[model samples]
Target: MSDSIRLDKWLWAARFFKTRTLATTAVELGRILQNGQRVKPAHGVKLDDMLQIEHAEQVWEVKVLRVLEVRGSATVAQTMYQETEESAEKRAKAAQDKKYYREPGASVAGRPTKRDRRQLDFTRN
Candidate 1:
């Protein structure tokens, strides 16, 4: 591994974003921060650097454990960073909350089947 890497590249390698463009966009949009400071995508990432990333409606706090230039498999990418304990707890809580609340139509599962629609129509009358 090199001594450092660009923030966007590291994020891509770590699998935070599916593509480099997405990573760059996230960095530009203030969704990704380094040591609590906003940074350009070209910002250098070094060992033990802290990052706060917001994605998929959740915020993650992680420490860069290793730096790599190339994107790797999920398992390998995961090894590049370590999520903070608090972040993990917050993510878990958020996931639980989302599961309980859910989207307005998640349970509906798209348009109702004909039988279900007929039942609804009968009940409505």
Candidate 2:
């Protein structure tokens, strides 16, 4: 591995993002923060650097443990960073809450299905 890796590359290698493009987009949109500040996708990621990542309504605070440029298996990628305890707890709590209380609009993905349309029409009548 190299001495340093780009932030977007590191995020992909660490399994935080499925693709480098997504990582770059997230960084550009300020979804990824390095040491409490937003940084460009090309920013260098060093060992032990703190990163706060907000993805899909979940937030993660991880400390870089290894700098890698290549994306690897999930098990290997997991070792690249260490998530803080507080972050883990918060994620768990959020997951639990999501399980119990779902948004009313969560089931709406696209146009209503045939049955849904019928139901809607019946309600309108």
- In order of listing, the candidates' clash counts read 0, 0
Among residues 3 or more apart in sequence or in different chains, the pairs in candidate 2 whose N, CA or C atoms overlap within 3 Å are: none
Using TM-score, give the best candidate's number. 2
Ten contiguous residues minimizing lDDT sum, candidate 1: 101-110
lDDT of 2 by residue, 1-125 (tens): 68789999999989888989999999999999999999999999999899999998999999999997788799999999999999999999999999998765456579878877776666667
In the range 4-92, model 1's lDDT, one tens digit per residue, is 99999999999989999999999999999999999999999999999999988989999999998998899999999999999999999
- Which regions of candidate 1 deviate over 4 angstroms? 103-125
CA RMSD (A), model 2 = 3.6
lDDT value for model 1: 0.91
- Using all chains and alpha carbons, the TM-scores for the candidates as numbered come to 0.82, 0.86
